[model samples]
Target chain A: MRITSETVADGIREQLFTIGDIPGVLWTPAEGSGPRPLVLIGHGGGSHKKGWEVVSRAFPYVTSCGFAVAAIDAPGTGDRPEHPEIRRLVALTQEREAAGEPFWSGPEWPALNETVAAQLIPDWQTTLDALRKLDSVGDSRPVGYYGLSQGGEMGIRLVAAEPRITAAVLGLVGSDWLTETAARVTIPVEFVLQWDDEGSPRDSVMKLFDALGSAEKTLHANPGSHFRVPSFEIDSSIRFFARHLGGPGTASGS
Target chain B: MRITSETVADGIREQLFTIGDIPGVLWTPAEGSGPRPLVLIGHGGGSHKKGWEVVSRAFPYVTSCGFAVAAIDAPGTGDRPEHPEIRRLVALTQEREAAGEPFWSGPEWPALNETVAAQLIPDWQTTLDALRKLDSVGDSRPVGYYGLSQGGEMGIRLVAAEPRITAAVLGLVGSDWLTETAARVTIPVEFVLQWDDEGSPRDSVMKLFDALGSAEKTLHANPGSHFRVPSFEIDSSIRFFARHLGGPGTASGS
Candidate 1:
């Protein structure tokens, strides 16, 4: 990975880097005495390394809690140029959405999903490989993963394939394709579920949760739309990761 | 089917009707002395009974050739009320399209495509059933099918299921899912293929044509984009349908 920029902000040292062809960011507590636990973030579709709007908001809180955060743009979004086929689809989607249209009920969704899955899983693994080699994050540094929606959907594959990730926070990602991946994830997990997600039905969400193979997993659910995750719930996820990755007595990392 | 409007212009009589819940239109020679051959039309995605602009432009010519023509809005388009799921999908498609975004490189396209296929084929069959009963049509009317792009993609299923369709003109649609459907379509076919379709690669289009089960089928290929079917090709399709559905010497139905 090649570092492109480095800056200090609010007691955090943030660096922009590229791992192979994938662009990413590293955020760590500037005053930490030793190597801190590392958290890899997966941004959703139409999002970038900064983790989209919702995800970007969490970087500061997670970093202040004494952990390093790293995130890369999902394959077709952010700094990575979108594939030509994907570019066409995004244009069509935007045109239809502007007309107040829906997208899921057609036959194209499944194929598009497959294309995206094929593109994302490898990048997630590559990002993880590059992050673990950085000076701020040694090979043995405890690694955690946090992703929701597109992030969570793809993170399942990453966590299942990479055993180095000690824990993961997965949310708003529910699909039958995850059944096998969920079964392979033995890491500590805190899965977030929103009850009324039009994009992802509740039953599918529950089915994904039910399929997780983790021995130590918790289900944190709320009754709201998929994008409406409450701050308290977000804190719970932070606490969950802190307990597992930041060592005991570090739950409040502050 | 319930006829709602009837008008005659330039020797063609056009009747607007509803087959079950699907809004449709019937075009026939106003001077036809008896029940002429019938050709059912399947409009493309985001289009209605009138067909997309391209297909609509061909209607009078086809009707003038001594054949009755019928077309209905595919599920979620045209006069038919869009399915709630479809509406959401269309809105999303529009939103993504307008943003110059890429969508299908993601996983959603396949699922949405299946939903559209499931909805369209049955509606096509139902419309066919209702169309045959019209006094202006009659039970023994020789039947043919015509569809392009979204129309052609979904028409494979309809033609395979509806044996009464003696022939079909399908083009500008190419997907692996059509392999099995194409294998089941035994009717005489005049398949159209555009060489430079960004939406449908040439190899896939040729593969679909090669997969057709028909003993007597022809490929009418041209060098153009998907939406730019040449006028001569349209005439060739008209003649093919005439040879299969209308009597000999009726190729020029003028």
Candidate 2:
């Protein structure tokens, strides 16, 4: 069989936005076309949008097989300006780490202003709405998301709260956040669990899966740690969005 | 309860390791008391040892709770010898992806050279002998191995080839290798599977677990993708190692 030349060129392109007074950077793909299924991503604790490059570059290899991906640095990471909520989160984390609280030993640094919680759900909504509004991305595509660690929580909340997400990939995090944000969601979800993830253990995923009000669900477990980033994980994320998101490359029927 | 800062510091520290063949950078942690259980980790295809920094460094965090950890990066990737086998594996991937042939996916990776194949079992032995011979790791402690993707296959082979491995962690790889290498292992094993991994999905893990010869075994499934590395994966890797591999920081008594 003759080999196909599948060209894959990737980069971090961005748009600036504000979550209230806090300035934020929307990290997205440079080569998106046709209503590329948007991928609104969030970063984990202590990290920002910079942590998302792995997915942005990798999704195209698979997602590009059919969709466009966009990731946003949470309020504090990357070029985004720090919000007052971030300050509160830091202060709370310090106090907890000082008190040597058990949660410190667990994942999640801290979120001081619970209102940031309210703003959090809208981050993806705002991005997806904007992406759909983009001239390049008209009304023909379904948006999706992939998040890791702390971002995993954000991704789950977004899809659960908004119907815009046709599909979603949650890596190393859980949907427990939905108890407050989304009581139920209809989209098909793919969950990627890291076997030895300390930040969010197996218990978290199990609990979250049980809470999922949706019936369309899939799960994959691979032996890995939070620190190890490799191509395999990238491949999975790409394949996932390719399956769920609607794009010129992937027909809604596919 | 007054929490000790030392414990927290140690818990967070196992996650750190010196990368590359910087002569000084070995898996051995800074001087600690007594000999600890040893583990040699190898990475999946198209990757190297240092390639696992994201996954392997947290071994110490597990160690702080008290078992020493070392992430093994096989020849090639993150500073290992460019062995012929590694070269072939890379070539196969490039060719297959270019071929764009759907059949050329999953564990269909070309076989390791007979030399590499024959040594799979012994390579681990050599690693153990080398570790035991090290000034830092003595023979007083037990040893085990853990691997992911391609590494997962190797971990099983290593344990199956050598009884030195008291426990093994296998994730997202072919289960047949266990059947091929079953006689060699006689330790506890943990298998993690994602419900919808693009490659080796959930059924694969159950098959591997069912075929395994170990008297002590457990199967864990998570909602995740092959690409989305999870926090639980890291937590489990470290926890498994800490329990099987004896050292100072890990919680003992498994």
| Fnat for each predicted structure, in order | 0.00, 0.14
lDDT of 2 by residue, A164-200 (tens): 6777766566545455543475576666666556656
lDDT of 1 by residue, B1-254 (tens): 78899998877788888867878888877764455677888777777777554345447444546777888777777777748877777667667666776443334455667788787778778887887776556766688888888778877888888888888988777788779989999887877777567778877876887788886665555555778776545655666676677641233234
Native-to-model Cα distance after best TM-score fit, residue A153 in candidate 2, in Å: 1.0
Show the lowest summed lDDT stretch of 10 residues, model 2 chain A. A1-10
Task: Name the runs in model 2 displaced over 4 angstroms.
Answer: A1-33, A52-63, A98-100, A104-113, A174-183, A246-254, B1-254
DockQ of each candidate, alpha-carbon based: 0.01, 0.07
The best candidate in terms of lDDT: 1
Cα RMSD, model 1: 24.2
C-alpha-based local distance difference test score of model 2: 0.55
Identify the leading candidate in terms of DockQ. 2
Of candidate 2 chain B, the 10-residue stretch with the lowest lDDT total is B1-10
As a whole number from 0 to 100, the lDDT of residue B223 in candidate 1 is 50
